[model samples]
Target: MSTSPTTLIAVPDSLDTGTPPAPAGRRWQPQATHWAALSIAGLLLSWWALTASGLIAPLFLPPPQAVLARFGELLAGSYMDATLPQHLLASLQRMLLALLAAVVVGIPLGIVIGVFPLARHLLDPVIEFYRPLPPLAYLPLIVIWFGIGEASKVLLIFLAILAPVLIATAHGVASVSPLRQQAALSLGASRWQLLRHVILPGALPEIITGVRIGLGAGWSTLVAAELIAATRGLGFMIQSAAQFLVTDVVVLGIIVIALVAFALELGLRRLQQRLTPWHGQPH
Candidate 1:
């Protein structure tokens, strides 16, 4: 068939190729934001209804409006002693520091151990012993080791965060296919060369996954650490508020932690997307 030149149209490479051929099957692509928004609305509505109906007392459950107002109050420096910014900074600093320490030490050790069966076998039992224990459960020992200052808090957070990173990194390394390793070997790649060029990149996405999850756990541990020995973190603020029956401040602190955690998760997701564009993307 002959086509006229005038009938032809140019399309950019970025343009969608329209509907792809079906594989005699179907899949659902759900938009997460809509569900998330609806969930928030439902929870708020339930809270409002329960409180307004007097079925839930204010002492036990404050209204959403009260919490929202308290959030604003916190931002405006209405709270005493420690300001909102100080608490946020303190928590963020601790979380970041501990997360860094965990990643720096854990990832290397995990990769090394995972790439070698003997190392894994030797260390697995020790790892299991430490991994199952809660950071709080080791509070006394950590205090004794590092004292009750920032070191203890950082150590506790690091312990809480370390296992996930190590586990994830090890799994990533172990999961590298034998085929890839064989191919690299056939290409005359040395042990160090294969590790540097093939294994690291393959394992990076999983390593990032570990880091993301570890950061979250580290943040949680930070709250616990602060609640116990902190003078300036959001957890300390919440603890103080609880003692004074200042539900508003307590709610504010909870919301702050939630907001920060949510923000960190979102940031990490964006980072993952940027780092691993191939992840969950169709060929």
Candidate 2:
């Protein structure tokens, strides 16, 4: 009888072992909110330390306590002919008006540009030209043409907001899958149906992102906008405080502006997440 040679088959480590493989160790990662809170705390601590150490003059950088006191005073009383709430309301109104105008005009124009090469060719140059210029550069021209009235102020912010919205919207529209458009067309989808069902939905995320960016631009331009002979607004308040060397009020205004902008961004981010949960996820 001839002996047969033993044949061996390799097995996976887990199978070769009687027990299952051990899981890899996972490092402990801090939550984003925790990190954010820690960072804010650290910043406040540093600010307090710098002020408390007397290294910086209160004339330049008011202590956090003085700023807090100023905030309370502003809330309870008036400054620059308007109370804090009044000033905030005025700023909010201008910003909202500009935002509405940008959305109404930018979305449609962006769609047209994205859809038609002719529109893009005619409009892209104008947009690119003005988009690069700072709002203050054309402030005098706007004031000259529209007068230093609410029109000029709102228009200034409107122009600041428009380019971002238009560009982002156009990008979003262009990014819509061509295959999806063709499929919709093959399914007897009308132009209106294609836009409503396919393009608009696909582009919404980018549109929101554009609006968020536009909002930041508008806020930055707010000081210049309010410089046009305005009696009330956060920007006006800040400028007024600066001129008088009311460092506390100026610091307070800066803090308020930062807080408001942060709040608006947070709100927009929440809205975006609610509207487009699938956005930014792996397909």
The backbone clash count of each candidate, in order, is 0, 0
For candidate 2, the TM-score is 0.89
Q: Rate the local accuracy (lDDT) of all candidates.
A: 0.81, 0.90
- Per-residue CA lDDT of candidate 2, range 1-283, in tens? 1222223433366577766444433324578999999999999899989999999999988889988888888896999779998999899899999999999999999999877889999999999999999898999999899998998999999999999999999989988989999999999999999999999999999999999999999999999999999999999999998999998888788788889989999999999999999899975
lDDT of 1 by residue, 222-276 (tens): 7678755688888888888899898877877888898898899899899989988
Clashing pairs in 2: none
Tell me each candidate's TM-score. Answer: 0.84, 0.89
- RMSD (Cα, Å) for all candidates, in order, is 8.1, 8.9
RMSD (CA, Å), candidate 2 to true, equals 8.9
